[model samples]
Target: MSKKLNMSRRDFLRLTGMSSIAAGVYTIPGVGGVLAQDEREVTIFFWDGPPLIGIREKALAPFDDAYPGCKLNFTSVPGGPASGYNDKLFTSLAAGIPPDVFIIEIGLLPQFLADDLLLDLKPYVDADDYDLSQFPDLAIEAYTHEGGIYGMPDNVASIAIFYNADLFEEAGAMMPTAQWDDPEWTVDDFFSSCEKLTKRDGNRTTQYACDVTGWDKVWQTWVRIFGGQLVDDPFYPTECTLNEAGAVEGLQFYADLRWEHGFAPRPEAMAMGTTALLQTGQLAMFYSGSWAFPNFREVDFNVALGHYPAGPGGRANYVYYYPLVVPKTTEAPECAWNLLKFFNGPAMETIIREGGLQGTSFAEQEKWFVTDPLPPANKHVMLDAARHFVAPDPVLTNFGEITQIMQAQIDLLMIGEERDAKVVCDEIVRQVNPLIKEGQWRSG
Candidate 1:
């Protein structure tokens, strides 16, 4: 581990000119580097969240080796308010001692942008020799608010349907395809297939055809298949378009998997551990994101990947990508920018390859669809899913709140509490409309 310099609030404040009392006095203890001439030190604040994999020792080594004399300091912090890290960050920023750079999910970008806490990185992209074309378009679009770019593309989390190949083979069903225009399976085809593979011992279902949770991916995918946007527009995020005909049909389809069709895991059985159920062959299929891919890979049974089943609208997916950002409070914006560019550039490709992580870099995007290290049958599913993928509503700053309502409404529909699709859609619209209207909408 490299030696890290101690950065004090008073020292940074003095250097940044927050205190006007001491004018033209460039004498601050322990300030250095590109920003300052004489041995100045730059301290950066980094999130202690699971997402910031680069902050780890092995991942940070290459950057430190490349950029000698530059020092990076990190403070460990949890991810959420429930973990009290949010409060810690608030207090630090309020005291003008926030980290130089922090991690913000692309989903949460609207909130930080509205608050004016993030530094615009459009100039940095233009100034450097960095290849902006190397980053994934979806990742770029996610962080680009209005006309400005706020962050570099980090790792992306995308959803893919995980299925048991043994089950499919036994049921004599063909695997799902990644071809968007001509998907191998439809929504009804998927349900019926799952239903066929499911095993029942008495009244209780011994094996579930699918495990559908109240997660964002499933809901968004449903809306996409039914030809409805999660919001009215793609560029500017807005209200619960879930009330729309297509969206309601999607939601109902999701709910009906358990209640109407009995092809999914029962509400009570879901908490018994989905991973275990899948591994034990009790669940034939699981709808989840790529982040959970590693977990399922270790199972003894053979696993396969498939695109989300097609509905009336053909094929669609709920795409998720995270963008990296530099906070406005950082002491070394230029150095931070350099580091940001380096990671998004080819230098990070080495890390991605070594880490065995699924990413959405431009170079890798077109190739993933054809890769066959996964289950032999559904080779091109992931890259195929990217097309016709619907992003989360980009306008609303309150993702947490909106997801809460989405989950709640879906839960009600799943449990048979809400049978009328239009009524549920109307209720979702009523709950979400006001929140969307009040938020600062992002521009196309």
Candidate 2:
């Protein structure tokens, strides 16, 4: 974590040359008195995780310095168990005390939007003449609902394959390319390479060709590549479509790698987990998000990034992002807006450069993203993949419940409890569709 400075408010104001302004007057660097405002606190609720806490603190420093009167209070809640953080947010909202600013994952945006929990940022953008074009189209579209943008895109990432170069060399297997247009780098080639790289000793396998998690996002890339989608429309999903032929085919291919082909290791096979296997050189390739870059960089093995293998859908991948939004009940909307803009704009560039995790949605910052001594020499591959990225199926409400249900079925399939992909996916639809309908009814 970044060390906090122990300076008094008076000393900080003195050092920063910020003097108290009279009521009904505003002060900025060059701008004179403008809007009428008073000192207030803006509470921001965001997820807690490694590197993120440090990164957020570093990124928020500039905003903190600029807006001294508007004290920024941040609450970091643990992510996952998805219900945990959302419960806290809802409880706060119910009590008529909502966060001024909060982070919303793209997957859960629909539920928040349906509940009227977020403030529409369109008016603010138009009034300020903010260039929405600065962010990627997909990133912007993810937070857009019925023509109004509700959130500011903060962090964007695309799924890709991370490979151990040394393992490839040892196995006499061809290394995958970071180039998206590589004709030879198809799914067939990827599977053949995995076959060559996988090795066994007696009944116990010494090394695996690839490792993938039961996480829906990681495996969903394959589904999209096979020309399938989990829902009819990601932005406005109404029904589950996992039982479709294309989706079933994709899930079968994913399952076969573990059960039928034995090319990918099962979760139980790796006692220390997939990351440990990758670091120990026992795993050749792994599919994950851009956030894994830093973790892989720390390992002794030489790591390189590779594009997702092309399939019938033509190199499809999954894209995800965190959006900064204001609740409808915020007491300090203007201050929250200023902080949100800073977080999505200037702070993004800093995060990309210093954090070395994922790239920002801003196009101009692309140059800063791919540069430097980062482990994956071809970091641009992730940005390239973003062009063909797919968003998660929109679960209109009760997103956490729906995801849990789907993931449970996926877990059963992965662990050999269910052999048929179609059966598992069918079961998912049966259990999840009613919950979605019930949620829609409640929201209605």
Candidate 3:
């Protein structure tokens, strides 16, 4: 009384127009076990930058060859110096026209997740048995929440001290170790080198030892080195811990670089910003992320990479990555997932290699990165530093607001509007804790 069903591989392939055996095995709805012949168009949203240029020029061609049936429609959004991109993205989402895939910075992931904006990628990842072991642990950990993987990392980067070799040689200061575990390369060593490199003309400094331009996140690394935390826990921050003794000391040390040591630049003193200053040989050293590599290569000065100074808490730096995320409302989740895998996977490797992206997230790519003929000839320093990176506050969804509140107090201290580090830390705790509590209460 049972009916016999028969289907050949060729018959299935002909029915679905699928190019792969795997595609034929996985069923698409309404087609039984056959893949659909209809071409799927996936829209991707990403920030417009130099790297995007490389991606389009180098990565896209290979991706097309690999998956001809899937069409990629890219939309470049503006970033940096303003915050319009997020607004635009939110508007698109509200209008029910959100891009299938988009880039989400690690700091913004919590906010996006809290709003239920991202699709859980766990199902796709598990179905394929994707070898996530190829990526750095920190990179994977950043996008994971509540047993769900929301995205895959596009690139990974961390903060490091970039120094001018000419200045260091002229000052007779010992160069910082490129090795993370170099015992002698401590905070004291960093300060000592800065002291020696600083050049002053009477009351005016001709050349500063360092530029503390973007110290908001940089300062957190220092706090960790000094055995302190900006909050009770970076991932699940319930209360501000900047008022702790170690944190106060770390902040005090940072403030001292400008107000006390007279080596680091003050806001008014930096006219052309860190890039120009470093290029012109006016600034000896500055703390910045690996994104500076491309621009630094264009300059005429001799630049080398140095590790973030080790501290009592052991070596520490903030690790960050922008993940390629799929929105929950995507019309073609399967096609979007395919695009995400291809773009962040092997097809994108050539783009990353040629683009001079220093901190690639893939383990296999690390060898290529280190061997590439690039400045900071000691490129291995970044890989070493990655071993000790600290993930940022995970539970705090209101990063933008909290950062603004904390920065305001820090700015007051930096500009002499406030003097005492302890007082400033106390003020930050008083102001930011309420915001966190309010957010938690509302969510609850």
**Candidate closest to the true structure, highest lDDT:** 2
The digit string of per-residue lDDT tens for model 3 on 1-444 reads 999889998897786675554465554432421344566667777665666454543565565557766667777665631457677777887888788888766667787888888899999999999888766677777778788999887666667888898889999987878887788888888889889999999998898898764368787777788888877865566888989998888878877888888888888777677877888888898876666777677666678888877777777777666787888878778888888777667655665566555435556457665776767556666766665566555456776688888998889878766768999999999998988775452231
Give candidate 2 misplaced runs (Cα > 4 Å). 1-40, 67-69, 78-84, 440-444
Q: What is the lDDT of residue 7 in candidate 2?
A: 96
Model 2 steric clash total: 0
Residue-wise C-alpha lDDT for candidate 1, range 1-444, written one tens digit per residue: 999988799898877775554433434332323335533244443444564344443455465556665555645565544466567766877887676666555557788888888888888877765566655466677677667888876665557788888887887766565566764689878877867877788888887888767676776778778887677775675555777888888877887877887778876787877777888888887866554555664666678777877888767776666666777877678767766655555455554444444554656654553553644335356555554555645556776687687678767777788877778778878887787777645554
Q: What is the C-alpha local distance difference test score of each model?
A: 0.67, 0.75, 0.74
RMSD of each: 7.1, 8.3, 8.6
Ranking by lDDT: 2, 3, 1
Instruction: For candidate 1, list the clashing residue pairs, or say none.
Output: 31-40, 32-39, 32-40, 32-41, 33-40, 45-100, 237-395
| Model 1 quality (TM-score) | 0.83
TM-score for predicted model 2 compared with the true structure? 0.84
lDDT of 3: 0.74
Worst 10 residues of 3 by lDDT: 27-36
